[model samples]
Target: MTLPVEAGLHRSCCLIDTASLSHNISVLKKGLAPGAEIAAVVKSNAYGHGVRIAWRAFVEGGATWLCVDSLHEAQELRDDGYTGNLFVMGHIPPAHAKTAVSLDVRCMVYDRRQIDALGEAANAASRPLRLVMKLETGTQRQGLTIEAALNLAHYIARFPYLVLEGTATHFANIEDTTDHSFAYEQLRIFNEYNDILTANGFRPTLRTIANSAAGILWPHTHCELVRAGITCYGMWPSTECYVSARLLGKDVDLRPALTWKTLIAQIKTVPAGSLIGYGCTYETTHESRIAVLPVGYYDGYDRAMSNLAYVLIRGKRAPVRGRICMNMCMVDVTDIPDAEPGDDVVLLGRQGGESLSAEQLATWAGTINYELTTQIQTNIPRIAV
Candidate 1:
C-alpha cells in the first residue's frame, strides 16, 4: 500500500500537533493570576492551524472560553457542537444580527448601530444577549471613547434584551516594546473608564485587558479574562515581548506545533551562469543542482520570500533560488547532490537536528510570525497529529 504522501495525494500540507497545542495552552494558563479565565482566540482558523482541530485541544488544555473574530466563526463553532462560552470580538454586521443572536455569542461592541441591530434581533428572538464594551485605550481601533462608552452604557440600559457584561481594552504597545510605560498608561485609562462605569451603576462582571503579552508579563493586568492569541499556538508575539518576559523572569515554555511540508517534484543540473526563474532574478554561480518544490506564493509562501528563504532537505539547508512563482519554487541542492524527487522538504518545522522557525520565515517575508502562520492558505491540508 502506498502512503498518502508518497502517492502525491497532497502538494503541500501542515502538520498540526494537537498535543503541542494543548501543552502551549496549559503553559500560558499557568502564568495567569488565580481566578482569571483563559480565553483562546481561535479566530482566523486558530491562526491557520485548523479551528476544528485546535478548539478541542485548547479545551482539553484548560481554556475556559473560546473567542472568535466573527459571527460566522461563532456559528461554525456552535454547529461543530462546541457548547461553551463563545465571545465574538470582531464586527457583527447589521445583516448578521439575527445569526449572531441565534448563536448566543457574547459580542465586543463599540458602535451604536451594532447595539441597535443586536438589541432588536435579541428582542425578536426573545433571547438575552451579553455584550462587552471595548474602551478606547489609545489603540484608536475598534473602541469607544470614555464619553461614547458612557453614552453606550446608558443606551444599553434602555434595552432589556441587552446586558453589558464586561469591559475590554487592547494594549497597542505591549508587544512592540520592552518599555511598557505606554502600555501601563493604557491600562490606567482602561481602569478609569471601568471606574466611571461602575460609579454610574454599570457594574461589569468581566474586566479584560490582558492579551498574550500582558498575560505573560504582568499578572496584575490579568483581571477577569485573559485573551491568549499567538502565544496560544506556541509563537511569541514579538522579540520585545520575549525579551521583556525573560527580563521579568517569566519565560514560560512555548513549543511551536506547526510543521509545513512539501515534496520535491523534480531535480535538474544547470551549468554556471544559467538564469533561474521569473525576471531572471538569479543566475547559477556554479554548476548547480536545483530541486523544484510544489509550494509557492499561493500556498501562503510569501512572494517576497524569493531568493531569501531556505528549505530543509535531508537535514541540510537548501537556499531558495530566484523569484518564487505562483505555484512553485526552486532551491539549490548542489551541496546535497543525493537529494532526489519525492524527497520530503520541510517548509517550516524541525528536520533532523535543525529547525526552521515561523519567526525566521516571517523575517524573510518582511512580516511577523502571526501573519506568517495566519496567512497560510486554508486549502492546504492540516493534519492533526
Candidate 2:
C-alpha cells in the first residue's frame, strides 16, 4: 500500500530530520543503564512527526519499545506491521480492550473497572492481556490513586488473564530543580508501591517513573524503562531540564528533528500606509517588500502568535504581520532584498547563521514545546529526511 505523498502541492510542511531524531535517541539511550530499554513515546502522531515515519525512525534508532497515547494509535502501528513491543500509555476505553488484546498492545490500567474489562476481554479472546498499571503519584491524572494503588495492584494481579507487565508513575514537577523534592517524593511513592507489589508476590516485569523531563534531569528515577517523548523528538522537555542537565555535565545536546518549510506564494511591495492581512492588525511601517506564506492557524500555527512571531526567509528574519488567515500568513521580508515567490521560507530550523526552534515559537505563542509539536495538523505534509 502506498502512503500519502505531498507531490509538490505544499501550502506548509514540516521537514523531519530522521537522522537527527535517530541521533537524539542514541544520545539519550547512552544515558540510560546498560540494560534499560528505550520506549520512544510516539503518541500524538509522534508529536505530529507522522506515526508511520516516527515508528520506523524509533526502530531504526534502536528503540526496543514504542509507546502511544491510545489503543487506536497502537492498532495503527500494528496495522503498519510493527511487531515490536507497543504500549498504550493512555487510559484505554472499555470498548477498545478487545482490540488492544488482539493487537498485542499492552494497555495502561488506571482503575479496577478497566482491569475487570480487560480481564473479560482477554479471557473472551482466550489470550492473556499484557498491561502497565499506572499510579497517580502526583500528576492527579489518569493513574490509580495513591490510596488505592496497593489494593488495585493486588487485585489486578489476581486476574489470570491480565498480565501486569509493568507499573509506572508520571512526575508532576520534574523540571523544577528547586522543587525536585516533590519529584523525589514521587519517586519514593513509586518505590513504596513497587515494594508493596513485590511483597504481595507480584513481580512486575517493567517498573518506571520518569518521563522526558525526569529521565533527563533526575536520572535516579529511571527505573526499568523510561517514557521519553520530547527528548526522543529532539526537543528539551523544558528549559529548566535542559539547563540543569547541561550544568551537571550530562549529555543535553539534541538536534530538533522537525523543521518547518513552506514556499512563498507571492511577493509584493506594499506602500507605507498599507494594511496587511485581515482585520488590519498590522500596517506597513515603511514601503516594504512582503511575502505571503501559505500557512496559518489551520496548519497549527497558533493565531495568538499573530503579532509576535518570526519566520526565516532567504536566511534572514521576517516579522509576521496582521492576523493569520485560515490558509495564509504575511511576512515582512523587506530587508531580504532578493526574496521572491517560490523561495523556501523556514518557519523553523537552521538557515545560515539563524535558527528558529519550536521552543522559541512556542514561547512566542505563550505555550509549551509539547503543545507546539503536537499541534501540527495532519494536513501539512511531513517529509522524513
Candidate 3:
C-alpha cells in the first residue's frame, strides 16, 4: 500500500502537523477538571484531517478516549487493531448490534429498541456491552427525557450483560455567543437529571457534558470525560467562545494543525476589463497576472469564497479573482511577480508574515471553521508532518 505521504501525484493536500495536533490536545487537557479524561472527537474523518493519521497524534497528547459518530467508524478503528477506549457518540443502527458487540465499543443509546438489540447481542457474545445514555436537557436531538431516561436505566439493569457506564448531553448554544445563560440552563437541567439518576438505583460513573467550548470556559462541566471535537485539531469552537474564555480569565492557547495547499498549475496575464470565471463576477481593473490552482469546490474549497478569499504565494497575498469552479480557481498574482507554475500556494495556512486562517475562510464563506475544515473532500491526501 502506498503511504499517505507518498502521494506525490496529487497537486494539493492537507498538511497535518501532528506535533501541533498533539500540542493542542495537551493544551486542552490542562483546562479539564482533576481526574477528568480528554476524549478526542475523531468523527467525520477526524474533522477532515484524516482519522488514520490523527488518532496517534491525539493519543500522544494524553487523550485516551476516541469518540466517533458511528459504529462504522468504531469498527474501522477496531479492524485496524486500535484497542484504545473507543466511544460511539452517534446513533447505532439496531441491525448492526452484532457488529457493535464484536467491536467492544461503548455505544451511546437513547431509544429502547436499539438498546434491546445491543443487549441481545451482548448476551450472544457472552460479554458485557457498555452503554452511555444521551440525556435530553434541552436539545431535542438524540436524547431521552428524565423520566424516560430513568425508565431506560431500569430497563438496562434488567440485562446482566449490559452496563450503563456513562451519561452524556450536548450544549445547545454554548459556543454560539459570549452569553452562556442558555447553556447554563441546559447544564442545570443535566445536573438535576444526574442527581435524580443517582437517587435511583442507577448512577453513571462517567459523565460527559463539556465539549471543547465548555472544557475551556467552565470547570464545573468537566465531569469524568470532556469530548473535544474542534479543539483536538487546534481551533476554537467560535469567536464568542474565545471571547468568553478571555472574559472568564481562562488561559489557553490552540495552534492550527491543518494547512490546505496546492501547486500553481498555470499563470497568465489578463487585460483590463476582462471577465473572469463562471458568472463573469469579477472584471479586471488592470493588467493582472493570475495563478490557476489545481483545486476547487470539489477539494473542499468553498465556492462562496469566490472573489473573496486569498492565498499566500511566496509570502505574499494572492487575491482570488473569480468564482471557484469544480476543479480549479484563479488568484491574482500581479503583486507576487515571483510566483510561477509548480510554486506552492497556501490556501489556508501561515506563510512568512501572512496566514489565511480557517476562521477567515469560513467567514468569507459565511460558515464556521468546523465546517470549513471538515468539508474538505476525504479523497485529498492528509500528509502528517
Candidate 4:
C-alpha cells in the first residue's frame, strides 16, 4: 500500500517493504526455539521507518510483542489499534503511570521511587501493571544491581497491582567486535542474577538479555523472549554481528526493509573550477551537471556526508558535491545524462543494478546504521510498499 505524499513534503520519503520485514521475521524465528516469543523493538519510530507503518508490518510479520522506547510511543501504537503486547522498554515518567497502566503497556523499571505511583495507578485502573526488572550486568546504563533488583522484585510482589513479568539486561560490546568474550562475561553475570531471582522465588515470565546482535549470534541467550531490534528491520547490528553469525554457521538472511528516495528538485550546469555549496568544499573540475536533492542534514542525511556519499540517479552513481546543507545538497549527475528534475533518486536503496546500503552511508557519515535510520525525521512520510 502506497502512502500518499502530502503537499509541502520534501519529496524525500522512505519505502518500507513489508515482505522483507516478514522475511526477516521468519529468519529470526528459525533461530529460536518453538513457542519463544519475539518482541520487535519499534522505538525511535521503528528506527525512523515510521512507527505506524512499521508497527503494522511487524505485527503482520509475526511479532508477538512490540517494544518501544517510551510510554508515548506505546500509546501511539495502542491508538493505532494494535492489540498485541506493548512493552515500553524505556523509562516512563512517574506522572504518566496512570496513563501507561490504562494502556496496559508493560514497562521496564529500575527505580524504587516509581513503585508507589505505578501501584497506585494500576490500582486506580483496576488492572495489574506489568513490569520488567532491568539488571545491571555490565552496560551500567539503566539497570539495577542484583541486590537492588531483588529488593524491587520483592517490593513489586508486595503490591498486588504490580506484576514483575520479566527480567532483562543489555550487552555492551556484543556488536563492536568479533570477539564476544565480553558479551559472554556479561551473560554469565546476568545468569548469576537470574539465579538469585529464581532462588528468591521471583520467577519472571520472561528472562531476556539479548538485543539484535546477541539474539542473532548467541543462541543460548535466547531465553523466554528475544527483543529483536535492528535485525527485525533487516539491518545487522554491525559487521561483527554478520561475521559472528557466519562463524557460528547460522544461516540467517536479513533483507533491508527501508528504501530512502528523493526526486531531483532541479538540474543545473556549472563551469569548470566553479565551487559548489557552503564553504566551497568542492570545486567542479569539469563542466558538471548537478542534480539538487531536497534532502539534507535536517532530513537525517548527515552533513558529514558532504562530498563523501553517492546517490543513484538513472541507474548510475552521482557523487555528492560540496557540503550538505540543512535543506538541500547537490549531486554530480554528469555521468547520468538522462537525470533531470523530478527523476527518482535513490539515496539508501537499490536502483537498477546499483544499491546503496545503510552500512555504506553510515561509513561515509562516520556513524552507524542504527543512528542513520533513527535520526531520520519522523515527519518524513514512510510508505509501506
Candidate No. with top lDDT: 1
Q: What is the C-alpha lDDT of each candidate?
A: 0.91, 0.83, 0.91, 0.88
Per-residue lDDT tens digits for candidate 3, residues 1-385, read: 1224555777788889999999999998888789899999999999999998899899989998999999889987887767989999998989999988899899999988988899999999999999999999888898988999999999998888999998999999999998889999999999999999999977889999999999999989989999999988889999999999889888787989998888889999999998999999999999999889889999899999999999998899889988999999999999988888988888999878999899999999999999999999999999888
TM-score of each: 0.98, 0.95, 0.97, 0.97
> Where does candidate 1 clash, by residue pair?
none
The deviation in Å at residue 381 for candidate 4 is 0.7
- lDDT of predicted model 1: 0.91
**What is the descending lDDT order?**
1, 3, 4, 2
Tens-digit per-residue lDDT, 1-385, candidate 4:
1214642445688888888987888788888865577889999999878888887878777888889999888889999999888888888888988988889988889987788889988888789888999999889799999999999998888788999988999899999999889889999999999888989999777888888987788778988888999999899999888988899888788899888988888999999999999999999989999889999999999999999999988788999999999989999988888877888888999989999999999999999999999998888888888
Model 2 residue pairs with clashes: none
User: How would the candidate models be sorted by TM-score, starting from the highest?
Assistant: 1, 3, 4, 2
lDDT of 3 at 215: 90
Residue-level lDDT of model 1, residues 1-385, one tens digit each, is 1114522466888889999999998998888898899999999999989899999999999999999999889988998999999999988887788998888899999888988998999999999999999999999888999899999999998888999999998999899988989999999999999999999999899999998999899999999999999988999999999999889888689989999988899999999999999999999989999999888898899999999999999999999999999999999999997899989889999989889999999999999999999999988888888
Which regions of candidate 1 are displaced past 4 Å?
1-8
